[model samples]
Target: MPTIHSGPVCRLFVLLARDAPLGVVFRQGPRQLTQLFLWHTNTDTFEPGDRFVGNLSPERGDLSPDGKLLIYVAANYTMGHHNKGLPPRWTALSKPPYLTPLALWPNDEPYYLGGLFAARGSIEINLAPYALEDWREHKPSFPAGAPPEGLVFEYENLPWTPSNQLFTRLMRSGWSQVPTRQQSETVDIAFVKAHPTKPLSLVLGMGSGNSHTYTVHHEAGNAKTKLVGAVWADWDQRGRLVYSLDGKLFTAELDFPGKLQPSEIADFTTTARRRPPTPESASQW
Candidate 1:
């Protein structure tokens, strides 16, 4: 068995822009929490930037392909130790317990990002929307009464392209409890990394305890077999994917409509011995 390090083990979450050399990393200390840092490919060091004082995990947000926009889930409540206020009566019968408000942050800005509302749940950005305008105008909601037509309730599980053109969802295969109906469950997709250049291809990370990666082709209506087991993953440039498994790093090629394979790039278990911890290492892919 691998001996767990007892010292402060810093956890890092990196988000790299598809078209730009810039990236942002959220570092959580085993003993303390600090601000996020900026990473540039041209520089070997990471510089401190904005401080995130929220309790929400950093994995909840992602950078756009162009590296200009950031879409992330922001909490409706305030941060810190305080009693959670009473829930509205409508929450019991109709409304969701928490509202999912997505904030779109720009790289150029130091503080503000556009705030947009969506259904409360795990959400991700669909890199290829049918039309940019459709994505811009999309307002998702779940009411007690009749919901709007063509609304995507599973936007979190599947990637959205313009016109809902290419997407995937989890469906059940067993019989349903209801008479003459089959029961189905949505595949709890934990993370989605769309191809930066390909509109119809992307990778889906699923599973709760044991992670699995799958290559999806929206237009073909089929996906390849599990490519590998990964706790989390992110896209690099056009055809590369970086993922973490068993506390080690690996890279794979995105051969959509073809076989996908992964190769080990770095092992955190041993790398600690070679170099001291630094801000750049916290954001290293």
Candidate 2:
């Protein structure tokens, strides 16, 4: 077990192995802009990596299964009030019409990436066929003479194979409202992490307003299992579940055949309480 440090970590993932490499989205200095870092547990230090000047936090990115590829949403920095020392202004990272994939390798260079939008926090890549889900808008449905009743948006889970064929849709969401009502009963699923070996099982973080929960659901089946009530949830390659709630980290053993039992592995609640409000925290509306 690694010692929990006292600082702002937007997101983190550790490979399941002896001396596993740790991937983290760490908040930098007083500005609190997030950047990716590779942590070496043996030396207890972080390796220098790429930096995103904008409001790019850990919640907007994820690491590939092998921890070699990084996919993230690139948000532009917005200038704060002149009275207060702030950052520069820029536009959103995602463009209109379609979602693009922004990828980075070990050399800290950009590569031609493809998928859906990088803004979604819940994105996962699987082995064998190699597929990922992209959330974007689809065609609008109109009732014959009706003027476009509502626009349909879907998280099209696309798969790529060896054949020279177009990407196939693996999973699709039901038609949701245009603007998405705040009080809507629809539970938005995000922060998706697929099982290391099981292609059919997926662990997802579901959020509805202030309440959140983590659940395990089958991709081709309907058996949904609630794992824990948490704001964020992730699984390591070894089938162990790690999650954070109220700023504390907990680990659960899920190799068994039944219900999950999580234990408090590390506590950063005190560190979180002592920190000042970040720009991301203040911008919540």
Candidate 3:
């Protein structure tokens, strides 16, 4: 038996129960499984909760802070076919869904690097903004101007702050001058409690320069998680340090700084308010 703690998720297939104090969901394969687990710090053991099942693949999922609406994503498409038969039949070839209406976690897009959704918000007729080439011919059409007013960006870019923000790096080859301030796009900002008692910390991802970098911004006094050619998909908090990681579907604490060093990893699958830490063994002085 192991004791669970209240913290961030470090693995995939995690769901915090809304009714139960500590109901955690973990995936066994395609099917998601939930269990009631308890944390008995005295002996470092976990108790079990009732089981529930669901699906939460990264590409098709919707688990908000309160766990109410389950947003789902699927291809919205019409098929093309070649009908040539004595009886006049048709064959199905392709159905590609346009990806848009990607809801940034907690907010709609057009904001600085926000959480992305798989669903398209809207579709307008006669809006083939980008040039399309015949698949069989493999010939491309010349690029064009802005898309229709309602046309969404074909590809959505998540918030990512490049290193160049603080200082410019001089690259000898394949480099160009930084864009002037007027050319810079104002990015959307989302603030989460990075550390206890710290000023607002922002999920600094979207930048006018590059959309591939993700970094954390805190007041001058807090620890910073800088992007080093990686995307932080998930985050959890522990003693003094924020545990940022990937493939999280459950909660755990990262006992150290950065995502590099993790402390005694414990699962707090249940949603119970903070309880004083119960020592597994007698305190040592």
Candidate 4:
């Protein structure tokens, strides 16, 4: 484990982008710094490489399996403990904490979340998706203070129902005076995708449309397989998949017409992986 108390080190979480070969990493910090690393899966070795995100406080991040697009969630400051009269949850919103996300290519010029705030030593969270060149932001169906936490998605075990309803099981406190409550919420996002096998059948709704379900039919013979529910990491290429019930990462191979061949692979026993760090990168701070 890396030292957390040493001067002010942060935790860097790495995830693959929606469409790239290289991985993206986000590190937590009081100030931003650039640290890039390459992981040799075979040898379990980490090597230093180029500086990815310039010294930015990588608060949270999620990787798409295909390793293309890296979604990073960064904030100006963490929500600290204050306001004894109010519940802990109220601190999450006590101040309008600005969160700025930087979407970048590993070996290229990063699209910095620029503006006056960025110039003033403060990070900016532009909720405006239109400003993002290559990304499109979808409106969330659930209400504020709903079951899901975090800036975008900060919860686990989010399930989609048969009726196309999205459900989230979250443990929340400060919402009420009765300590944190284990809660759930459901909502519907109108979205659809063609079944991998049954071209005519539509797989409607998954992960606020970030995920979906489909069917696959073997062309050589007569066998129909239904993809119960699958989350997309990197389109049809090398992507990460999970069983809806067990939530395990399975290696996926997609055939031309949406047919999928998955192996019960356990690359890691955890849902998230801590990316290796680059030793030679400069500090963005």
| lDDT scores of the candidates, listed in order | 0.38, 0.35, 0.27, 0.29
In model 2, pairs of residues that clash are: 122-191, 122-192
**TM-score-based ranking:** 2, 1, 4, 3
In model 4, state the lDDT of residue 234.
Answer: 21
Q: Which segments of candidate 2 are over 4 A away from where they belong? A: 1-21, 25-54, 62-185, 188-202, 205-212, 217-228, 255-258, 270-285
**Predictions ranked by lDDT, top down?**
1, 2, 4, 3
What is the number of backbone collisions in each predicted candidate, taken in the order shown? 3, 2, 33, 22
Q: Which model is ahead, 3 or 4, in terms of TM-score?
A: 4
Candidate 1's C-alpha runs over 4 A off are 1-11, 29-35, 41-54, 59-186, 189-202, 205-229, 246-249, 253-285
lDDT head-to-head 3 vs 4, winner: 4
Model 1 lDDT, residue 175, Cα: 10
Whole-model lDDT, candidate 1?
0.38
Better of 1 and 3 by lDDT: 1
Best by TM-score: 2
Q: Residue 165 in model 1: shift from native, Å?
A: 19
TM-score of every prediction relative to native:
0.37, 0.39, 0.28, 0.31
lDDT per residue for candidate 1 within 15-38, as digits (tens), equals 566557655555544333434555
Error of 4 at 51 (Å): 18
